[model samples]
Target: MLYVPFAILVAALLFGVPIAFSLTLAGAFGLWITLGDVGQVVEVVGTTVFSSVADYTLSTVPLFILMAFLASQSGVARELFAALSSWTSNIRGGLAVATVGATGMFGALSGASTAAAAVMSQVAVPNMRSHGYADEVAAGAVAVGATTAILIPPSIALVIYGLMTETSLGDLLIAGILPGVLLAVLLAATILIWVRINPTLAPETYPSSWSERVASLRGVWPSATLILLMLSLLYSGIATPTEVGAIGAVSAMALGFALRRLTWQGVMIAVHQTLRASAMIFLIFIAAKIFGYYLSLSQIPQMLVTWVGHLAVNRWFIIVGIIAGYFVLSMFMDELPLMVITLPLTFPIIVSLGFDPVWFGVLTMMMIAMGLVFPPVGMVAFVVSASGGVALSKVYKGTLFLILSIFAATALLMVFPEIALYLPALVRGREF
Candidate 1:
């Protein structure tokens, strides 16, 4: 019964068990079966839990998470959206375009996709609706736009991927830059086209005066400064991911206070939220590590790698199959669970095929982006629908259309790996 552990894991998931518990239970069971010793399983569990989150680098996770929560509670989204919309207000369906821009900008601060979705739904959807935009358009823009948070720098997803694969965390974060911007551009373009095809979708456009546009820029300095600081530190190699995260969190809080948006109560809330989110992520990390030990004992990843190597088909064909599997699995699972569960199995196969880990990390993130907005169980779609007061069906329809832009962005990355690699390459003076 080499597959019994997986069967148990699937059953646990199907029964609505928490992912951390499901992984821990399934992994402990697998270790017991393979080692045939109860004492050994307990020992393994003890060691894995401690070692999993003990890395100095993993410290970045909580810090970035804090920065995100602080930014969320500090009224950053409102001013950020206003500033972006002022510039884009002349175009047809420009508010939706501005929503995407605002989301991406906010992404540099907040790496969590659901947080981005929730914040933008509150900030952008009401404004779009007041301007005569359709529910689908508004909902779709927020859902799709939030996906960029997972790709931008300080992304918790990228951080976890780097930890799992032993890739450089700096490179992984930097690698997401161009690709994230590309997705944002493509998403904005898609909204523009959608409005052009159906002018009724957004009947009126608000064109801002030059003075208003000029004044709007004043409101965005905090967000712009924070992002520039993150990029400069990262690009110049002046700080590690952990240091960057620490600086970002402190900067976000300081700016919040300076702008008179953050209060003592707000700081308490941000800290409380940060602790909860970090604990959850670290719990999963520990569980996934234990589960990975079980997989090693079972030799599943090794066996899969050998089997795939013997296939005579073109390598791209194999990549296609893996990507299709990711798309299907991600439709029902959240991105972190999907990454933690599948990376152990798929990463080995990807490495055996001579694929670049950093490139694959970005590709996996693109798939995660699609899953965030795809139908059936798109988490971001649910967040947007719930927060924006839009119908779930309308949000799903909007995401379905917006998902095409993700496909286009993915296709572009596949054609030119440098899009994700260029910035990362410059980080270390190494060529990819």
Candidate 2:
């Protein structure tokens, strides 16, 4: 029965099994029940293992992940934060605002939100605290800022969304650009408002000289050049996502060496990290694929879609319900597993409702981003807490306002779907 596999999944997760194993075992159980043949289930697993991760487009995962680690090793986050901070130093809550800017810039290079949050925690939290910024405000800014990576270009989250849903990968990546920028701006504005409302949260500081600010800009060129190069190739349609990822990875390495910031040891570490992360992601992919096969055989998604169509309520109510469900589940689960597990069911339902897949994909990704900073099991919050030595309570407290910003951004996107879909349309128009 459909209920049994899901019950098994919940039980496995409760018992502290690894997510990959949990998904594989639960899915295998469902297959054995439906097919009534262990050999058939074994056959499904064997084929899904090879077919799931073998796509050429999936190469984008490891390459972008490699670029992220290499960029981290090369000190991209440190320099970008320093440069942005110089410009914002005189403003109230300047360092925190700079942290948001630096996070957005780092998002251009890396697709991993946790990595962005961790790096910024190390680079920005100390300066903010030293400058009299509240621990909650500093940690909150870093955590929420990191969420931008999932909406920005070269986002691994979007790529995985595209691959799973059979949407246009390039469109999905491009679709995130405007929404990402909007979220970053809203976050910055929210910081300013919070500081204005409670001046004690951020004390004013002495301004930097023009010369000092100008000099600081020099620190940003390496990242600027890399961002520019990657965007040009991607927006120009000059290369595939895989090729762009490869170019970005190699260029990041070159910039690291050219600056003498990256050593042989650093390169080794990057490679090792990339391998581990990639393996984890692909394993999820394989498991989710098998789970998907089981779902198709069960026809659960098809049944749900038909059942929903027969309802008398309006569709937006259904949309809200689905989003509410995602928010709840995301609080308890990681992003990738959540996406892979639910998309197989949700994607078809949205399509049946006649909504655009790309739009829904962006919406789903933004929700997942919010989860990254949410309370309890929020991965980004934990990263900021551990890496910055901020109290976990303070980190959660800090994210409170920024989480509101995420909700606001999601509302705007819901009202005006164009916010997430405009650029992707250009891609369809051959303007990419």
Candidate 3:
């Protein structure tokens, strides 16, 4: 039955069917084969689709999606980048470094890599190019930096993973903060090192006047306040992740209104974009639930757990192998679909190896972050390249170092589980 569903899924994908449809078709086929009753298929599909979307935890998806759209459309990202660049522009490769810092902040608000890439590319890439930075360096900076968005607080990916695995969303959200900052700081350090080695890549500029710097900071206060408000609300337990996202969306709109940038056209466009993204994600969730149901019936997760339990190697090695598999799979697929499809299988293995599910969720997120800069199918890479009008090859060259930095970060998290666990524990208590 598993083989039949897997084959059908593969064929559907090969035939260019959308992943959501492919999953649904595969699940329906499995049900037909297993039950030999066509009538039951409708009932199963209805139940799965309804239950998946009806989940209270799933509410975070649309809220975050709407917040991202509002931020993008309200021009908050541009203002934030401008302020960061003014402060950091004096140092060698400073603007590029600032781009990473700015993107990390925006990542906290948006929590979606593609949104971070798209917004930062439009705001920072041209500014860096104007500052005489290399095209590869500028483009690569935005592409790789944007991946941090997913590892930052209020992350939609972490929220989804927590919901699927029955882990605390708050734990997953808080766990991401330190690692996200580490990745951004490391990337900035890497850029500084590279610029020092090859001065020709990024020419240094004189520092701006004190007045100029002070005035520039004034322009970005809205963004800063928004960040503080959202993070404080989440950390203080004043609001859930979804509520924080809602607050962010409303705050962005208010900021835009105060800045006179929230035109009617922009509002309509934001709404349209938010609806489209939300619909797509909801569909994927429904399809994955259906497929997961079929896999459960086949007892595949249990079987794989038993097999892993019988292995002679150290459990950590098996865990590493699973993480490596996710990395490889991410190269050919989007994170959402790949996560939805693979977690059902791989998650059980991780549990059997006696790893903390929250820690593994953070680990999984970092692996997906690496995928954002990986070649061919890396969504963030494509977004930054297209938006910045740079060649993909150049972006790839520039991101290579950043990607390695992310891998190093992943290794640190894997080796020192406390890094991911400590914040969650500190904020949520030991019971988490």
Tens-place lDDT per residue, model 1, 1-432, is 779989999999999999999999999999999999999999999998889988889899999999998998888899999999999989899999999999998988899899989988999999999999999999999999999999999789999999988999989999999999999999999999998999999899789999999999988998999999999999999999899999999999999998899998999999999999999999999999999999999999999999999999988999989988888888898889999999999999999999889999999999988988888998889899899999999999889988889999999998899999899888778885
RMSD of each candidate?
0.8, 1.4, 1.5
Candidate of highest TM-score: 1
Residue pairs with backbone overlap in model 2: none
Clash numbers, per candidate: 0, 0, 0
Segments in model 2 whose C-alpha atoms lie over 4 Å from true places = 430-432
For 1-432, candidate 2 gives per-residue lDDT tens digits of 776999998899899998889899999999998899999999999999999988999999999999999999988899999899989889898888899999999988889788888889999999898888999999999999999998898899899999998888888888888999999999999999999999998986758899999999888999999988888787778988889999999999999999999998999999999999999999999999988888999999999999999999999999999998888888778789899889998989999998889899889978888888887788889999999999999999989777888999999999999998888677668331
Question: How does each model score on lDDT?
Answer: 0.92, 0.90, 0.85
Inter-residue clash pairs, candidate 3: none
lDDT of 2: 0.90
TM-score of 3: 0.97
Candidate 1 residue pairs in clash (backbone atoms < 3 Å): none
Error of 1 at 137 (Å): 0.6
Candidate 1 local Cα displacement, residue 203, angstroms: 0.8
Model 1, position 92, has a per-residue lDDT of 90
